[model samples]
Target: MSNPHPLQVERRGSGVPILCLHGHPGSGSAMAVFTEPLSTRYHTLAPDLRGYGQSQVQDPFEMADHIADLEALLDREGIEECLILGWSLGGILAMELALRNPQRYRGLILIGTAARPRGNYPPIPWWEYVNTGIAGLINGVKPGWQWNIDTFGTRSLFRRLLKQHTPTAYHYLAHAGTPAYLRTSRHAHRALNTALRQGYNRLADLPTLTMPCLMVAGADDINITAQSSQETAQTLPRCDWHCFPNTAHLFPWEVPNAMNETIHAWLRQQNL
Candidate 1:
């Protein structure tokens, strides 16, 4: 396979496109965040990046390659310039694309992303280990008080929210001895493999971007610290950095209301 394209894409609404790119360890299905709220106000596009979710696994996957796929995707969709919104890995890719081809993006939104030179942030030591970060996050999100689990500190909140992304989250979790729909953990290994073998470290090559930017960070985000988010916001010439004080790395899941308001405010800022 030369280079397969990403999976199904949905384009809705009718204004400057807001292209949403999701992070890894999950499908683009999480795009429901923007799709639900902003769909009526602006044209929204969300594609499962290669090897993620339902997208076809494209080899030689890297930030630059993903940028190419996104460019092609936009051209195919007739989007000249749009509000580029990316989360985590998606955010980093959006920054790269916007920096390389400034005209391609009307604005940029960095959610849990960083540009090394412009932002004093560290890339994940091993992209293959991305899932571990997510797992640790999921475990941490569990409401708790006793910090020492090793000292027999068991919080019951986890016993409840543990199933937040299960079944449909991962599908299949239940019963004394019965089973439901099984969840297939597909494409993860391929993506992680791509991460381990090929990683990105370039930062100084970035173009000075002047697009109206919105940097949303979860104040309690452990994966990508708040400092990193602010640093990224400062890099963009025009940025409005808003830190959700009570949110986590998975802020969309943790603070949907605030995220919605912030994006809505951005839409107003975009005059969309």
Candidate 2:
């Protein structure tokens, strides 16, 4: 593959490799909560998928592009065999990668994701988009107010919405306000969802992914319901699933310590 724009990867620690893939509209940095904890024992490689964070995408792209990028990234990194940790959109891509070459991955840590996501995703209020755009414009014009815009402007609104819709996840994102949350390309975001909406169903292929899998879901996640994760887990040959109470789609961040403990225990149990 001729790499047009080489992915920007955040690599940490050293030992067994673990490819960490972040959620939609997120970057490699978003996976820091998971990567940092495991870094002491495992080498974690988190890449900002094309169009997210520093790995900017000029033209509109689809899921295939993302898969290609992951393939190229692994090849370039000399990662012939490794574990995969994927959240939300990353989980979908992880499944695709595993299906494409099941032998490459020894295990999978999937969080807040699904193989065939069903149910209507609640739409973000139109006013939030307008408010965010205004905030972005203000920041663009007066770079000095970047922090103010992030805190008092855009993030303030995000906090309110998350508090109302997902109070548990809100607690983490509200304070952290990670930069990756704002770096995603709108075009890329739209294209990725468009592709998913068009058609994405690999339920039948689940059996092919015979590697040990640890799946975690938020009990209250409407975006991709815990039931969805349960269904996927049932199909997989070796999958240990968990659904955390009082958490939503961003449960990984909401309860990082607990999540890490679960992951570590699962890894030990699988002897990976």
Candidate 3:
């Protein structure tokens, strides 16, 4: 599964490198908030995995393709060893990479992800249709947000409404309409979902990742419950786990400062 294609990376700062991997339906830009602060102290490398963002791929691919891309990416970057930070789908990739060759990574930071996904890929929830229609109606008048028919492909309405009724709602809503998000390939989205549905269980491999690891999850994240992260942490030999209260799957964006502080403190304590 050697991918000759090099992933498009977003690199920043210098010194120890930290490879930041974004979740499904996300590009390297999604990790900017977390990587920006860390870049001051550590070199951060965020890459758009194939079929996502600028690293567009036309042919079909799988999880193994992504893993190979990462391995190739590190070699291309001339990084012998680095810390890996992953969110959601990115976390799964991180674990796979570490499991494949533990020595290549110094440590790991996994956020809002699970080793074993619940695999609940139901058709668009009925409520989403209602919300999208409302959002579209609102957009027509106020021009506050953009509307698209591919609600499943573009989560503009869902992301907007998830933040609840607040001034930030508009800001959150705008995320779906952003060029980066909009540019994400719908084919990439379905590929990952299909992989999950086919059964993604790495619980058995958790104990093999001996590197110092940090696992964080949002309590309110129904997509990947906090309990799943805790279970994965318990199996790991060296893991620091945390469950952020009053947060969902997108907790990093919801509480960026707190998440950043927690990661910084952990890295300091571990002397990483």
Per-residue lDDT of model 3, residues 77-159, tens digit only: 88999999999889999999999999999999999887885422246666766766665555434444333323331353454
Clash pairs, candidate 1, are 7-55, 165-169, 166-169, 167-171
Residue-wise C-alpha lDDT for candidate 2, range 1-272, written one tens digit per residue? 23546999999999999999998768888788889999999999999998998898767776688889998899989999999999988998899999999999999999888898754355677776677656545544544353544554444344332212233343345433346667889867787778867977889989988999998988877778889889999899999989888766767766778989999999989887
For model 3, state the Cα shift of residue 228 in Å: 1.0
lDDT, model 3? 0.77
183 Cα displacement, candidate 3 (Å): 1.9
Q: What is the C-alpha RMSD of each candidate to the true structure, in Å?
A: 7.6, 4.8, 4.3
Structural similarity to truth (TM-score) of each candidate? 0.71, 0.83, 0.86
Q: What clash count does candidate 1 reach? A: 4
Candidate 2: list runs displaced more than 4 Å.
1-4, 120-178
- The segments of candidate 1 whose C-alpha lies over 4 angstroms from its true place after superposition are 1-6, 58-60, 117-207
